[model samples]
Target: MHELSIVMNIIDIATEQVQQAHARKVDSIELEIGTMAGVEMDALDFSWSAAVRNTVLSDAERVVDRVPAIARCGNCGLEFRVSEPFMPCPACDNVLVEYLQGKELRVKSLVVS
Candidate 1:
């Protein structure tokens, strides 16, 4: 699965950050995952454990924060949260909605010591 590659990349980045910061070890890695980011959280978690097996971040805990998909309707100016893609405006049934959040996957923070 692509999740393996994704986790591998994450581990690589975390390792680099840990080295750069000259930390003894990485305690936690926080990730912000949007609802529409198309990433499977469970798979990512499983892959993370496997990916970090032999790395310096082997003991690092992966924390995922779910970010809701928020969009504003162009026709009605209504804002709402969505769980999936192709979300039409509920109020005006408008297909044109500007997305304010979601579709994002990023490492938000790292706790090192």
Candidate 2:
């Protein structure tokens, strides 16, 4: 799965950050992963376990903040939560909308020590 690559990339970033800070290892990591980011949590967890072996993040506490998808109606200017990308606006039945959030996939914070 692509989650493996994603986890590997995160490890690489953590490694670089630890080196830059001259820290021994990462104590914890906080991630912001939106629902619409298309990452399966189980797959990500599995990938993380394998990718972080002998790395700076090997023993780091991992925290993921799941962001719910939100969209703004183009026709009615109404903002609402959405479970999927193509969801019609609840107020105006508008299919066309702009995503306000829930596409994020990033490392939010790292606690190094």
Candidate 3:
């Protein structure tokens, strides 16, 4: 699964941050993952357990903020929550839309010692 790679990347980032700050270890980490970020939470959790061994985030408390997808209609400019891509606007029934949010995967914050 790609979640393994994602977890590995997170470890790399945490390791670099710990070394850069000269910290002993990480206490917690906050992540922002969107509904359409193409990541499976279960897979990510499984991968995290294996990927974080002997790393700075091995014992860090992980918190994930799930971001809901939002879209705006190109024709009516109506904003609405979307679960999938290319959804028609409820108001105008327009297929052309612009994504306002979602599709995000980023580390938001870290608490280190």
Q: Each candidate's lDDT (Cα)? A: 0.85, 0.94, 0.92
Comparing candidate 2 with candidate 3, which one achieves the higher TM-score? Answer: 2
Query: Which runs in model 1 stand beyond 4 Å of their true positions?
Result: none
lDDT of 2: 0.94
Sorted on TM-score, best first, the list reads 2, 3, 1
Candidate topping lDDT: 2
Please give the range of 10 consecutive residues that has the lowest summed lDDT in model 3: 83-92
Instruction: Return the clash pairs for model 1, or none.
Output: none
Cα-based TM-score, every candidate: 0.90, 0.95, 0.94
Per-residue lDDT over 28-82 for candidate 2, one digit per residue giving the tens place of the 0 to 100 score: 9999999989999999999999889999999999999999999899999999999
How badly does each model clash, as a count of residue pairs?
0, 0, 0
CA shift of 22, model 1, Å = 1.3
Each prediction's RMSD to truth: 1.4, 1.0, 1.2
Can you write out model 1's per-residue Cα lDDT over 1-113, one digit (the tens) per residue?
88888888887888889899998778998998888888988888788777788786799877888899999999999999975687899888899999899877898999988
Candidate 3 residue-wise lDDT, 1-28, digit = tens: 9999999999989888999999989999
Point out the worst 10-residue segment of candidate 2 by lDDT.
83-92
